[model samples]
Target: MRTVTVEDVTIGEGLPKLIVPLVGQTSEELIKESEFISQLPCDIVEWRVDFYEKVLDFSIVSSFSKTIKKAIKKPLLITFRSKKEGGEKELPTEQYFQLYQEIIQNGQCDLLDIELFMPEKEVSETIALAHQKGIKVIMCNHEFHHTPSMEEILSRLQKMQDKNADICKLAVMPNTPEDVLTLLTATETMYREYADRPIITMSMGALGMVSRITGELTGSSATFGSAVKASAPGQIPIGELKEMIETLKLS
Candidate 1:
């Protein structure tokens, strides 16, 4: 897989990148929290704006995101995960599309997360718009119930690559050890077979925590870590994640 540059950060070509999420309720809290997280070992920061109290207000979201951009030196990825995919709140599809469109037009973020489960047309338009503005698009799929077959997972990743996604990401919940193994297998298979840019894959929850720590061996290029709080199920703290990645490299 080739490296994708977002601002000064180059992903997929070095130690697996650690992405921390920002999930604050108010604008002031978000700004203060981002300032603190900026000093961590985070290579990328994702703003999970679905958790924000004023997410529906375009001005507030954009302003607060720009404030974070100024506060953090690492690359910023604006993400509004949908409620269907284990997000904090529900977002109607049309409203979701419009919000992302506006954000991409603003050009504040280095990357954007567009869920693959969204309507194809909506996803396509967002991808096209982001690419046109030179903003990297992270096409993502999240399945919190069960891990799909390796074939299905690979196919979904291939679809994201076909759609011109700069990165393809998938997170699934594992019910057993075999399910975690399946996720790792699918991640390696997808990166070997279909990945062109970069791939971020992990199985969520305690049983699947190993996936987050083993990305260097699994061919994944990035993993999530907690900053102020963990947005996902199996995120390790940023400090611990950094130490683990370093240990993995030395081993």
Candidate 2:
């Protein structure tokens, strides 16, 4: 069976990378949204579960998981981002960890993304468990405030690598054009240094919009775009982003 390998999803390449938004706050709404998203030609659908009203309820999440899998044939990425990572919820760290473990154990997602700052031991355990269950772990870190220096950006990517992540994702907000340049440079450098592992690097915000769409040229394995409303700043609609990527290919 085909799977999302370290460097790419066997099914996700060549096709434009898709970013399905997670906007609904209720289970019914999310189910409806999942059905709606499934009709689109997205490469992946990410359930930003942090926005769900019943995020703490395992049963609700489990039900949503089954429904989403049934509704969408595309790869599903489940993420319950913590407040510290620019997410909406603020569950206790322990509770969040427990929820993450349960999702890995029971949720039917193809990929589970955990933040890099989670307790190291706990995070390692989660990665091991996910691998045991044939789920990919995407270790991610988001710096929503400002872009760090190239060196710092590279360090974060290395940290994710050390966590034995199937894919490494780093996002930062850029204050200046130079900052955006630094993020892309770091992405290129990491791709060259670790050509075996897939790395997703992007700059968020209006100033960094161009970087998000064009990262593929710099060796980024994937880029995110919104299908409905944007989850983050500078997210162009998926349809528009798809057209741009195609245009770039033809150029």
- Candidate 1 clashing pairs, residues 3+ apart or interchain: none
Model 1 agreement with the true structure over 104-213: per-residue lDDT tens digits: 87638999999887888888888989989888999999998999998888988888888888998999999989999999999887777767789999999999999998
| Least well predicted 10-residue stretch by lDDT in candidate 1 | 58-67
Tens-digit per-residue lDDT, 90-142, candidate 2: 98878887887788777788888889988999899889999998889888999
Superposition TM-score, candidate 1 onto the true structure = 0.97
What candidate 1 gets wrong by more than 4 Å, as runs, is none
Off by over 4 Å in 2: 1-3, 6-16
Each prediction's Cα lDDT score? 0.89, 0.80
Top candidate on lDDT is: 1
TM-scores for every predicted model: 0.97, 0.93
